[model samples]
Target chain A: MIERNGLQSGSQDPAPEGALLPVVQVGRPADVPRGRADAARNRARVLDAAQALFAERGVQAVTMDDVARAAGVGKGTLYRGFGDRAGLAMALLDDRARAFQAAVLDGPAPLGPGAPADDRLVAFVLAYFRFQADHLELVLESEAGRGPGARLAKGSYRFWRQHVAWLLQEAGAPHAGTRAEVLLGALAADQVRHWLVVVGRPADAVAAELAAVARSLLR
Target chain B: MIERNGLQSGSQDPAPEGALLPVVQVGRPADVPRGRADAARNRARVLDAAQALFAERGVQAVTMDDVARAAGVGKGTLYRGFGDRAGLAMALLDDRARAFQAAVLDGPAPLGPGAPADDRLVAFVLAYFRFQADHLELVLESEAGRGPGARLAKGSYRFWRQHVAWLLQEAGAPHAGTRAEVLLGALAADQVRHWLVVVGRPADAVAAELAAVARSLLR
Candidate 1:
């Protein structure tokens, strides 16, 4: 299970040491226990509302005020929870990332543990491509100003890279680690945007092509 | 035969309409012809000096004043020729890019016209990886703050993408255009930096892995 690390103060925090490690807070103010449950509920509601609004109207058109109003929460609560629109986007991405991680960890075959490594690799590429295509706007917003390689520093990226490398290793691929980096580099958000948006390739077509490339690597 | 488009004014020019088209300048002041040749010589001298200084010391440590002094050009000439250090970096990269392009077009087999599609593709990837490894600093500096997808708009990127796509097509690969984008995406500057610098992979090893991936696509 993925641990919610709480809201990052800003999405641009430099790569923290052991960024993927789950740290449980040991102590807090006496009143904080009651507040934590409410805060979690509020955060979920805000993220749900933001996701719907972002889907309905593009990300740039939706404002923090709009998100707060739609979530039926105070603007103060929304701001306190997310800091800004980019922070909200990052949180939404984090939320989706955790869910995807869960699916890969414990869900079904192909993407989970049951399928052969090559099948799982193909499935992962297809699924991740869909995830990227679905959240392109949010990913771009969250990663803006952070350089291209900044994602490599994120826990989610480390997780993806490790998973891909493991799959390659399982398939007895030579230079698995290096090849995994190159494969994932091909899936970077900007590259996805270029393929799907700028080049106007169909999502299915792009995903299929990428999946083929993934399968090719297994050889 | 690459046409010198003269100084780009700045390297961050937005994707120009007919960006790769050759434009011929028609008219100038009576004295401008003499000034043009002098300007070309001065530009070459400054670039050579900057390249040497950058090679001697790292790109960051070499100042514009050092380049001007080393090249025997004044500070005004240095700034006038290259705008700033990033501009200078871009110009140097452009110079190298042109040379590479020429080699690919007219040089020997494997990288040139005589080789089979798969062989050419592998050769191109290997040669490009080496080019990227050697000039990582220059590429990063030239691309700073321009965003990750910014390179896609560059004429050089367009050229590379077209060449890869053509080679893929020659090999009868499906979805050649999309796959080429994916392949070139793997060779992105930041990705190369992450593999070579951050992850500490040997450049030759990375290049070999990438070449294998490229060759796999031909099947």
Candidate 2:
């Protein structure tokens, strides 16, 4: 609802927004493909429509009804499928977040697991920015309402923080836990958003510099 | 203007309502203080009133009339002195920003200019948190659009970024410029605001960790 100082004439509060989805996982779901095909297709349709709407009108301007109409679905179907706007946003993050986790966990050596921590940290940072460059709007959407992505994913940030702490431990430093928290906090999504979007800094350069800075900490 | 989301709020873009301050410098005169003793007292009364009103009701809720009434001054005099709400907010930032700058630039060796770059980096970060600890609200206010403290002096970040980059260079890594940007960007005010206010992390602990992270990066 924050308005720009100069836009007095255009000033207005935001819409009747409510959080729909549970962003953080309360419990682990089994790996069974439980979703019906029709549901999956409808979900895809809604997401596609929502992405287009978001790009054109912004995350704040678009409503659930708008999304349903864009997807050629009834409003009930849209709500049934995703619960609400926040839920829809969370669903969008599911695939990307998993893929990101997998990339760091098992994809390749540097960004995965085989390389040195310093090099892996660099690769991870570069990959993070690369993902951000590709999926800026989607990533930002999940961050709405200080919702799920705002918190530590038990398996995600904890894993990375542990990795960083281990690296610092290997480097023979004290306060590894605190150091990990600091590193993760510094490398947070908000920082990425500000740098890439608000400050208009080039992503590749930022990634390189982030990596270098990470190296400096460990070296 | 931005009312609660439950209301089908008529696009009350709260952006311009709360922050009415113009982005211009204020109150300088060619002659000696133009205001008589009474005028000086009135100005002080207005400032005190503004701060109290802002504290009781957020910056958004307090109107110029409210400020004028609280200060026991005419609304016209208030406007003459402050121009607008945004200008008044900026005025508040003046003393705070100077103190913050001094804490970084001249307070003590670790945070000041004389220590090793690595230690200085740690010191600067801790100092940033200390500033936040004392003036969280002002810090937050200045961060939003065209708030009083937004237009920081030239190279405000440069001083810290260069310090970090120079540390990297001293550690036999030459191209530290972009790295410095990333480092500084990661730890900038916006990120701090999210961490301290939204995420609810303890500023003191985060500050300590930040210093540790800086040390790890430079060590």
Candidate 3:
């Protein structure tokens, strides 16, 4: 239980809120889904081959047959492993996302916690933007068929929102829940891509401004 | 032009900025897409009939045949005009959306520009939520096939974003552009519906909290 600070009250940490620790589901034994070890190895080999092909020739030019040939696997194997081109793209996205989430959960300060609340908040926003900056194509590809405004429901998004909300509460911010939501939404990849790429703003400036805005919103 | 006083700064309205007038695409002679007047009337009649049917029986239960029968229009006319059942639903959504936008542009005080910028901002957030609350089904209907994160690109969203940005600039808020984007994103139909309906918070309280969050973000 996050101690209920009056939407306006203050609190020194209470001892009972163990489940609501600074570290979240991040450090838990990750439920990394897998198949038979040999089968999983074959899957990884196929994905690596597909990733290299995508990087070299671009997604549009690479076909399933090309992936099979590069992985040295049969077409039947590729077909059985991945339902289709889109499915393959999503699996690659999921593969990268796990690592990203892990880093945010347990790796380092600012992004991984143990920093001041404001600093942690700032780091999270910039980290999200940088991730999008580095992998715009993959991020966009993974989001291809989502319903309008389904953003709040994405698995990673729910975690980010909860993390931000908890941080804001710890900092004694009023309306922390809504503020965290707004902050996350503002840092959405689509908007970040637009501001960073299309609008030609320096990435650092946007991150700094976002940090300032986040501070302004906090009490 | 909108006066840019700090949220804590002072201003009795400065000289007018014509480009920044209260009226937007709202008061412009609405180009109601018209066919022959009689054709338009029949379209309206069919839509009204469809609306009643949808309200009486859920969307899934009501079919095109039923709509055509209720409207006294031939099945071919329904098919030609709407393309299919989902098309009819979208057309209905578009119809309501156009009205909503028009109201914001030209409607009475608080919602329109007659009120102070802060008041108008609050009204706009509440009004948006109410629109979603009243027509969740229609709004969701229109969003069915949208690509992920496409919410920011909707035609109405662009207009609302512009309107909110303009209001924020007028109110002397820092980072009006980014703040408005975040505010709008947080109030996205999906999040609003989840908090208000799924979470069982009273509509008014959520609206009030949203208004407070918007104000806090300003300056």
- Tens-digit lDDT track for model 2 on B1-219? 322231211011122333322122222223444337776677678878989998898776788899899898998788666555545664566556555556655677866767776666666767766765566555444443331113222223444555567765664444566545445644655556656765688878778766666555553
Q: Please give, as one word, the docking class of candidate 3.
A: acceptable
By DockQ, rank the candidates, best first: 1, 3, 2
In the order shown, the candidates' Cα RMSDs to the true structure are: 7.0, 11.3, 11.6
Error of 2 at A123 (Å): 3.0
Residue-level lDDT tens digits of model 1 in B82-119: 65555677777764666677678778988989999888
lDDT by residue (tens digit), candidate 3, B1-219: 112110110011111211112234433333433345555555666778888998899765787789899999898777666554545665666545656777777788798869999888988998988888888766665434333444554445667788999898888888788778778877776667667666678888778878888787776
Instruction: Give the candidates in order of TM-score, highest first.
Output: 1, 3, 2
Docking quality (DockQ) for each candidate: 0.45, 0.24, 0.36
**Given the true complex, what DockQ would model 3 score?**
0.36
Which has the higher DockQ value, candidate number 2 or candidate number 3? Answer: 3
**In terms of docking quality, how is candidate 1 classified?**
acceptable
lDDT of 3 at B142: 45
Report fnat for all candidates as fractions from 0 to 1: 0.58, 0.34, 0.56
lDDT of 2: 0.58
